[model samples]
Target: MIAASDADKWKKALLEWDVTSLEEHPSSDGVCVCGQTGLLWMYTITNDANGAELFPIGSSCVNHFGRTDLNRRVDVFHKLALVQATANAGKPVEMTTEFFSRAALKFLFEEGAFTPDSYNYGDGVNDYEFLLKMFGKRDKSTITSRQGYKIRKLVTSKIIPFVLADPRVR
Candidate 1:
């Protein structure tokens, strides 16, 4: 596990520079734990040779990550997974950390889960009330309301059907 101090330092360094030098090979192709294809960008900590470490930064990194097209392909995979999961569950499943972190934003966007206006949610009151209502209706045995909202929005949206109808999720 990366220490908090180290993580913070890395974050600071990343913010200061638009790009970092490749200490070694810049990228590697692999499958994420969620089964999605991922490009792991490697970086080395020059400050501490004693504590030298290698880490896989996510695709969001400007450099060393996969091409934009590959990221989009991976996003499609994530959306398909969500659709399959929802269909198999026979009900809308809540979004878990596993879903968001592993899933692609494009899929969420296509599913109407990510709308510019929807994200606004007005102000504190509307957002809080919506959250409260969702919480009240949540299935205690499953995931939390926060997770449910994300999953449900995506499932209900027409985007999944429009985008993936060829595969026939049902």
Candidate 2:
């Protein structure tokens, strides 16, 4: 077990960056190689001592050992995992955390879910009541209300999968 006070020693021993984040693996059973044991994706901590000693650490240990930035990335990956799981299940994911992350918002734009008035529009792209922050709004003015409804249904069911790997409907 590494004590927090020894964190600096660990940092000083690193031949490379003090920390490196590994993407979460699909198997939750993988053990964290830090002195602590349990399932969490592994992080590689490499040190030059004795010709480069490397070991894996859990996401929690990243912060506990003073690698807060890596911890944030771990959180982002956790959300991504949730989104992917929902997508694989063929369920419709909303724009909430379970559906997507802020980092992933650009996917909708790239997919042409809705074109913003400008690049800097941010979350103001479309604010439909139930679908606030959703990728697009059903434009009734351009299409009749009935057509808009049908399009929404089709987009929610079909276009969404192509727009994002994550489910895009309730």
Candidate 3:
């Protein structure tokens, strides 16, 4: 993280920015504009008025800028990162039930992950219905092996890529 020489200027700039995208780094090498280093999660914030952008900002710095909305967004990305890490390590991500809340799944759906083009479970269950069913299962033990496999596949193939795609800055 590079130290901001003009703290007031940077803070004012941050107030005009809103989080536009989020990304996860495999290693803790991310640097925030605020001079904080070792960030594993990076956020892209864009200033709407001037169309300027700052990326790879630490979540704490974003919160310190009073953007709690980014904090909530971070939680969703953090959960996805866990599944992404597990999948990248060749582990089954399906057995985990604690990572995704209904809202997170809904967010992904809204982002076009579970749409007809992206996912077709082929079991006659629509994406929204599938998500509802998955969320309804209260425990990992209740999630069948098939369900688990589907969950892992969905996270790896659909949700993660779509959510982490680079946002088109205006």
Candidate 4:
């Protein structure tokens, strides 16, 4: 298992590499799918006051239907990717739908963050929801099926940008 110190080190490195716009924006406290809680980072993507995305900092793994090692690595890689994606965009990108749903999954599976599961848990929650809980957001109901699908699209859209812009992963 990766030590907390090691994880912290990885987080720090990822922050240095990705988090570009460090200016403080409005944020809220929420739970991740994993059941952890902290200040969730948020960003406004629209000129209108209503268009904003809330991203929980760390999420859980309850929904991950893969091997332990893969799940852990994917979790770690995603933490790094989130910081990088935010930095690259210079604002809070949609964490719930965009970041976690798409890019994070690819990074997790492609990077061998987790191994495929032989059996399905068939739980109502998904890996993303699990991540949300892990980060401390308790309300799994808040994440909807549609939102999950959107997140997948968002991640697929941003893959090229993320890989092209960030040389570390390449």
Candidate 5:
């Protein structure tokens, strides 16, 4: 427990705590230690004059803490995943889909998007909704070019231009 007098310091440190790791999946079969199952894995730096500690967190906890950057990164990851899927479909791989996705992912990876980099879970909520609208399926891999060619219009007109303007979320 933090000392009463140290409350401010703890809050400040928490606001600045670096993301040490992230995983798409949980280590346990399903439940987070926090007891929620099937959530994103996030690890934080726990430290001070006393030394250091590490904690595993879920999206709910991160949201509770108001960590906007963490949330934003997750958003960016979902966007990147979509960009990659579009690339696989040859949407704009020859244009900017491949380049932007690669660069965006590299930026996140360098910032510790995943420690030991695991995907035990999967893409976040925003990604699911977006893909569902475009492909009628959650897994982009299952989409067929013949069936999805018209979806390319949406990608070319919206997503590609969106990423080109601000790849990591404006």
Candidate 6:
């Protein structure tokens, strides 16, 4: 379903560009730089040499570069979308261990959303420690309602706003 443009101008425009950031469309109505339509995610690519930025490019076009950094960014974007969706749904957001995998938590951690002193439940234990403990429990039945509430609040208050304002994936 993905194809590159055959025109020389398009080929030239595609080269030497690196993805800077991505924007998610509420619907699949976006068009790619290569003329691909029906894209839900649009990537912005910039040429540092010329300071030229092309926007609304689809993920397939980005994948054409085969860059690991770009791929990782795409993955982060998907995870961000999931978090956003839950936050948008309103109160009582569920932070299931399976839903928030180790990678997703690590991404949040790396994004500076989680720190040693961020979560202090008056028990001398930080949020990072509590989250890691919850994440390790594979048994869904072991996760308490109170723990789920804390995780939900964390996602709603911290992660959602951070991702919405500035993802910093680039």
TM-score against truth, every candidate:
0.29, 0.44, 0.65, 0.22, 0.36, 0.66
**What residue pairs clash in candidate 3, if any at all?**
1-35, 2-35
TM for candidate 5 is 0.36
lDDT per model, in order? 0.40, 0.47, 0.64, 0.39, 0.46, 0.65
Best prediction by lDDT:
6
List runs of model 2 lying over 4 Å from the truth.
1-27, 43-56, 103-170
Clashing pairs in 5: 24-121, 25-120, 25-121
TM-score preference between candidates 2 and 3, better one:
3
Of candidates 6 and 1, the better by lDDT: 6
Off by over 4 Å in 6: 1-18, 47-51, 96-101, 115-133, 167-170
After superposition, candidate 4 runs with Cα above 4 Å error: 1-78, 81-136, 159-161
Report the poorest 10 consecutive residues by lDDT, candidate 5.
112-121
RMSD of model 4 against the true structure: 18.8
lDDT score at residue 169, model 5, on the 0-100 scale: 29
Q: What is the lDDT of candidate 4?
A: 0.39
Considering summed lDDT, which 10 consecutive residues are worst modelled in model 3? 1-10
- What tens digits encode model 1's per-residue C-alpha lDDT throughout 36-123? 3545433222224224433433334433333454354444444455555565566554433333333344333444533344554633
- The model with the greater lDDT, 3 or 5, is 3
Instruction: Candidate 1: list runs displaced more than 4 Å.
Output: 1-72, 101-103, 108-154, 157-170
**Candidate 5: residue 63 lDDT (0-100):** 61
Please list the residue runs of candidate 5 whose C-alpha ends up more than 4 Å from where it truly belongs after superposition.
Answer: 1-10, 26-30, 40-55, 77-170
Alpha-carbon RMSD of each model: 12.9, 9.3, 5.5, 18.8, 13.1, 6.0
